[model samples]
Every structure is written in C-alpha cells, then in structure tokens.
Target: MYQYDAYDQQLVDERVAQFRDQTRRFLAGELPEDEFRALRLRNGLYVQRFAPMLRVAIPYGLIAAKQMRMLAHIARRYDKGYGHFTTRQNIQYNWPKLEEVPDILADLASVQMHAIQTSGNCIRNVTSDHLAGVARDELLDPRPYCELTRQWSTFHPEFNWLPRKFKIAFSASQSDRAAVRVHDIGVQIVRNETGELGYRIYVGGGLGRMPMIGPLIKPFLPELDLLSYLEAVLRVYNRLGRRDNIHRARIKILVKDIKPEKFAELVEAEWAQLREGELKLRHADIEAMRQRFDQFTYDPAAAQDRSYAKHLEQDSAFASFAKRNVLAHRVDGYAVLFVSLKSPSGVPGDISAEQMEVVADLAERYSFGEVRATHDQNLVLADVQHKDLYTVWKTLREHELATPNIGLLTDMICCPGLDFCSLANASSISVAQDINDRFDALDHLHDIGELKLKMSGCMNGCGHHTVGHIGILGVDKHGEEWYQVTLGGSAGNDASLGDRTGPSFSRADIAEAVERIIDVYLEARDSEEESFLACYRRIGMAPFKARLYAEEAVEAA
Candidate 1:
C-alpha cells in the first residue's frame, strides 16, 4: 500500500475543512442547493431515493487492515449496520445522514482514504487488476503505474470536469481480470519483441444505453510516454466531446461519431506536441513511486507445511472451500484467498460491520495486515500463506464469509437497484435473491460452471450486466417490473457485449427464465467440462432465446 506523505495529508485535511464549511453552509441556507450539488458530488455524496449514499474510494482496490477497521466503524456508527461493495471495488453506505457527511470524510481521512472523485462527471477512481502483483501470468506489477495515474489526475484542472464521468483501468496479466475493455481508457501492459515494456491502449469502450468494447487506438505506447499519451486522449475528448445532451456526452459517443481511426489520429497529433513535455515519465520517477509501496516478506518454507494437505484430505467442507475460494499466487509459499460476500441468505456485495471487522482481523493475522477489494464485489487476502489456509477458512466460515461460490451462478454481480438508487427503473436485489433461491444447490451451481451473472437496475450498467455470461437488466414496463435478459457477454481479454433475448420477462418469471436458460445450456453442452460461456458461444443465442420465449409464444397461440 502507498502511504501518504505530509503534502498528501495536508491536501486531504484542507479539503475536509473546506467541505465541512460547505456542508454547514448548505444546511444553514447560505449555500444554494444547485451550487451545493456540485460540491457534494465532488466529495462522493449522493442523495438517493430513501437517504444519502456515501461512496468511499479504495484506490486500485487496496486497503490496509486499519482502513478496513475504519470502514467497519463508519458502517456501525454512521449508517446502517452494513455497507455494499460495488463493481468498481469501492464501498457504499446507503443510509448516511446529510449533516454527518463531513464527519465521515474526516474519519476516512484519518486512514488516508476519502470519497474524492467518486461521483460527478469527472475522472472517477482509477482501477486495476485486483490480482495485480500476485498473479502468476502478470507481465508487470501495474500498481505503481496506477498510483502514478491517481496522483496525477486527483485534481487536475484540465481534465476534472469532463463532458461525462471518465474511468480508466489497467491489466498486466494474460487474462484481463480488470475488465479494461469496458473502460473509457484501458491500458494493457505488454512486452514487445525486444523485451521492452509498454502499453496497448484502448479507447471508447463503455456500457450504458450504448454498449461498446473499446477499440485499440495505440497498439504500442512507450513506457515513458504513458501520462503524455493519456493527456492527449483526454484533451481530444474534452475538446470535441458533446456537451448538449447528457446522453451524448461520453467520450465513447465522440469516438463513435468521429470514427476510431480519426480519434486515434487526433490523439496522435496532440501527443506529437506533448509527448516530451512535463508529463513524460522518467525512470527515477517510476522507481520512486514503486518504492512507496510496502513489499511483503514471504516465508520460504510455507509450501512445506503438511497440515494444509491434511485438512483438505480430512474435512470435505474445508476441501470444498479451498477448492473454490483459494487461488494460486506468483510466490511458491503464498496463496490468494477470496472471502465471498454472495451467500444465498444476503444481498450480493453487502457485508455487515461485524463481518468487516472480522475480515480486518483475519487480514492482520494471516495476510500481511492488508486486504484487497475485487471488481466482482469480493474481498481478498492476497498474500495468505498455505500453512494458514485451514485456520483462515474456519474463521471465515464462522463469520459467514466462507461461501464456496467464487465464479458460480449465485456469486453474481449486482447493483443497489430500486432499493437505494433513485435512477433505477425496478428492483435488482430482490431479483438476485429470487435467482439465488432457485439455484441454491451447490451441486447445481458447480454443474453450471463459471457463469458470470450480472444484473443492473437500469441502463446505467453499474452492475456491468452488458458483459456477463448471462446479463439481467431491470426494466419498467407500464409501471410494472420486468427484466430483459442477454447471453454470451464477457469482460475478459476477448470482450464482447451480450446479445439480448427476444422480450422482457415479468418479475415472477425472471428466475424461471434463468433456470430454463441454464437447462438449455446443460442439455446442449458437449461435456460437463464445457463452461456456460463456451457452450453459449458455440451454440449461439438461438437455442437459449427459443427456450426462454417458447412458453410465451405457446400461451399467445
């Protein structure tokens, strides 16, 4: 994790003081609602349907154990007893009072965390691979670059107030776990023939009403020109991106209208001027940023422990947990463990204060005092030793965090829907619960195999439904709740938007429709090893579409 220096501390403290005064003025009637709206949004506060929601940034999804404790404390003291982890790897409080926001910000600042740039039509949080430094296939550790980008863009006057919200993601692994293709700007760290490290930059990728897989703009960008190139892309979009209609304001719209080739040309022209300017990164600068992060000390003989194997052989429950929740690490002795928040009994991504506290304690005891939040709405202990696997699993199970459903159907990505979001057309949490109840059997979920089910309350695509193997979008049909389903979408290296089924289903039929879709998949698959995504890709949408709509067609006849 990157520790804050004096200057960083001063900047946050000063912003907290300023916001505190601003909040006070708004309540006192000195500040207008319209004016306060912008100020509060910059601080990541949103007035939801029922109450105020506060989104706190977990930069590149990394949080220290102490920071996790602070989050647990905030959840307990300020709002409801639980908080929701989002698809962007941030956390949200649904019931924070308006008057107490400044106090929350202050509490966050004490732990070197804040809600800055979490909302508004500005550059939002910069995200990267959750398995960045620890993944076995990673070509480079992207956290240093991510941190550098975060520092540069925090309050950059030129790019802060864009036409719409801007997102950037980085991935260094062979597998694109960061979903870089769906971001406004996606950077893939790669190596060329000469073994020189650089970036493969993609632009115009986004989801919403118009979903797109960002096209490759610059095939190979030099290591030293990272920031300069990014500035060029932003400059192009900031100048020509639409400002008339909110629907057409995103950079993706501009890229689409002008064509990707022309967008690339403009970026190149802009880069020709700024490539060697102040934004050009030097070797020393990169090294300094890398040095700021704390390095872990691995136990050399951790892999030699026999108790982990013994436990796996003796306990079926522990074995199942180890099989599903544990991941291979780049280091020989260490392992990455996922603490699932997707139990059938609760909302996806929602964790209680006590659960957060327990996770923090576990991180400190077993995983080098640090925890990571994943884009899939799960928490990670990235450096857990193999020797400590059983004890960690037992503790997590006791706290209701050890659900062995990492990439299963029940482990879905969902948004706060009509329950919390004012922009939602229908409820998503309840639908997720319905589907979970329908597919409660662990054997059934395991049989389905690696199905990424994502649901969003509306077209904002906050839940990333556009990229799920099975995507569910809540729709309002004549004041009634309905759902539209899509199939074969993915957020991996071979990214693609899903194709929609013929018609929307009533809330009552949505879960059954999902079940029918899975039934079709299981019957059509060549073997059990074939994943839902792979079978869907091979068989296409015709079979699933036919199965989903056949009953409706028959009833009409």
Candidate 2:
C-alpha cells in the first residue's frame, strides 16, 4: 500500500476541510438540497433507500490493518455495525448522517483514507488485481502504475467533470481477475520479448446500459509512456464523449457511435500531440512511487515443513478449507487466502464491525497486517504462510469468514440493486440469496466449475452482468421483478460480452432458470474438466438458449 505522501496528505486534508464547510452550509440552509445532493455524491455521499450511504476509496484495493480498523471504528461509532464491500473494490456504509459525513471524512483522513473521486462523472477509483503484489502469474506489480494514474486523475482540472462516471482497471497478471475488460480503460501490463515491461492498453471498455469489450488501441505501450498514453486517451474521451443525454453519456457510447477504429485513431492523434519529452514519466518518478509499495515483506521457507502436511492431514475440516481458500503464491511456503463474504445464506459482500475487526486482527497476527478487497467482492489476506494455514483457517471459520467457496457459482458478484440502490429497477441481494440457497451443495458448486453468475439491478450494469459466464440482469415488468439472461461472456485474457438469451423470467423462476442453464452445461460438457465457461464457449448459446427457453427448464423437471 502506498503510504500517503505530503502532497497526498495535504490534498485530502484540504478536501476534508472543504467538505466540513459544505456540511455546515447545508445544515444551516445556505445550500439547496439539490445542489448539496450533487456535491455530496461527488464526495461519495448518497441518500439511500433507508439512510445515507458513504463510499470510501481503497486505492487499488490495498489497505493496511490500521485503515481497516478505522473503517470498523466508523461502522461501530456512526453508522450501522457493518459495511458493504463493493465489486469495485471499495467499501460503502449504508447509514451516515448528512451532518456527520464531514467528520467521517476527517476520520478517514486521520488514517490517510478518503472518499474523494468515489462517485459522479469523474475518473473513479483505479482498481487492479487485489492479488497484485503476491499473485504468482503477475508480470509486474501494477500498484505503482495504479497509484501514478490515481495521482494524475484525482482533481485533474480538465477531466474532473465528464459526460459520466469513468472507471479504469489495470492488471499485471496473465490471468485477469480484475475484470479489466469491463472498465472504461483496461490496461494489461506485459514484458516484451526482450524483457522490457510495458502495457497493452485497451480503450472504450465499459459495462452499463450499453456494454462493450475494450479495443486494443496500443498493442504494446512502453512503461515510460504509460502516463502520457493515458492522458491522450482521456483527452480524446473528454473532448468527444457524449454529454447531451444522461443515458448515453459514457465513453462506451461514444466508442460505439464512432466505431473502435476511429476512436483508436483519435487516441493515436492525441498521443502524437503529447509523447516523449512533452510528458513527465521520468524513471526517478516511477522509482519513487514504486518504493511506496515496497512495504510488504514475508518469509519463504514454510512449504517443506513436515508440520504443515501433518496439520493438513490431522483436521479434515482444515484440509477442506486449505483446498478451497488457499491460493498459490510466487514465494514458496507462502499462500494467499481469500475470505469469502458470500457464505451460504448471507449477503454477497458485507462484513460486520466485529467481522472487520477480526479480519484486521488476523491480518496482523497471521498475515502480516495487510488485507485487500477483491474485485469479485471477497477479502484477501495476501501473504499467509503454508505452515499457518490450519491456524488461519480455524480462526476464519470461527469468525464465519471461512466459506470454502472462492471461485464457485455461490461466490457471486452482485451489486446493491433495487433493494438498496435508488437507481435499481429490481432487487439483487434477494436474488443472490435465492441462488445461494438453491445451490447450497458445496460439491455441486465446485463440480459445476468456473461459473461466473453476475447480476445487476438494471441496465446500468453495476453488477457487471454483461460479462458473466451466465449473466443475469434484473428488470421490472409491470412493477414485478424479472431477470434477463446473457450467455458466453468472459473477462480473462480473451474478453467477450454476453449475448441476450431470450425473454425475462419472474424472480420466482430465476433460480430454476439458472439451474436449467447449469444443467444443460453439465449434460453437454465433454467431462468434469470442461467447466461452464469452456462448455459455453465450445457449444455457444444455441443449445443453452434452447434449454433455457424450453418449458422443461422453467418447471421443476
């Protein structure tokens, strides 16, 4: 995690003071409700269905134990005793008083965290693989790039107010867990044949009412030109992106209207204006920023221990947890453990204050006091040692954090849809609960394999339904909740948007619909090794669509 430098510190401090003044004026009736609402939202404050919601930025999804404890304290002292971790790798508090939000901002600033750039028509949080520094397949640590971009984008004079909210994601890993394809700017970093690390930039990628996979504008962008290239991309989008209609204000709409080729050419032209000496990406700056992310350190000599194997074999429950929760680490003897908030019969990405405190404690005790939030809505203790796996699993299970379902169908990516979000047309949390309860068998979920069942409340695609292997989007038909399905979408190395299957189904019929799709996938698969995505890709949607729309699939049969 990048410790806040003096400039960063001063910037947040100033914003906190500014927000305090705004809070005073709003409470004093000096500012109108509408104006205050807009201003508050820009500061990550929202008036929710039942209360105010405040979103706090977790830069690149990295957090120190101290910061996590601060969040827990806030949840305990001010709002409800829990917070919702979002799919964008941020945390949201569902209940914060309007007048007290500034104090909350000040509290966040006390720990070097803030809620700035969290909402409203600006470049939002820059997210990357939560496993950025620890993942085995990573080419380069993208936290430095993400931090550099965050500094450049935060409060930029030109790009501050855009047609709509913009998002960017970066990945240095060979396998894309960050879902980079669905962001406005998806950056994939790679080393050249000669071993020079650079980025393969993807532009105009986004999911919402209109979803599209980003196009490769620069097949290989030298790291030195990373900032300049991004500047050029933003310049083009800000200049030409639609602003006349709120519904069609995203860069994806502009990209689709202009076609990807022309958009690429426009970015290229903009890049030609500001390349080389014209920009400011010196090696010293990169090194200075990179040093900030160099705080994490761990041991690498626990894998060969006889005690580790003995511990695993002794406890069957611990063994099950080790198999499901622990992940491969670049450092031998170390493992990355994913703590799933999406437990059976629970909210998808929520943690109570006690739960937060426990995770903070576990991070300090067993995982070096570092915790990360995944884009898939899970918490990660990135550097646990193999010898500590049993102890860690036991503690997590005691706290209800050990769910033994990392990448299963039950580990769903969901948004706070109509049940909570004012923008949603249908409920998401309820639907997710339905699916989880319906597919409670761990073996069946694990056996079905690699199924991403993403859901969004509506067409805004907050839940990223456009890219799920089996996407489900909630819709409202004559005041009733229904779901629209999409098939064959993926977000890894090869990205593709899902295609619509057929008509929407009632909320009561959705779990069955999903099961029918899974049933078809299970029957059509060549073997158990052929996962849902492979089967969907190999067979396409025709067969799945036939099964989904068939009357047999709609009924219990």
Task: Show model 2 residue runs off by greater than 4 Å.
Answer: 552-557
Would you list the C-alpha lDDT of every candidate in the order shown?
0.93, 0.87
RMSD of 1: 1.2
Query: What's the lDDT for residue 48 in model 2?
Result: 78
The best candidate in terms of TM-score:
1
In Å, residue 421's CA in model 2 sits off its true spot by 0.6
State the lDDT of candidate 2 residue by residue for 1-557, as single tens digits. 68888988999999999889988999999999988877887899988788889999998898889899999999998888989999899999998888889989999999999999999999999999999988888887889989999988999889988889999999999899888877899999988888887888887788888788887777898889988888888898889988899988888888888998898899888888788655658889889989987475555457575667898788877777778778888888888999989888678898989999989998988887889999888999998887787887888898889998888898888999987888889999998998988899887887887788899998988888888888999888888888999988887777888888888888888988988888898899999899788888788888977887768546321
TM-score to true structure, per model:
0.99, 0.97
Model 1 bad stretches (over 4 Å):
552-557
- Cα error, candidate 1, residue 123 (Å): 0.8
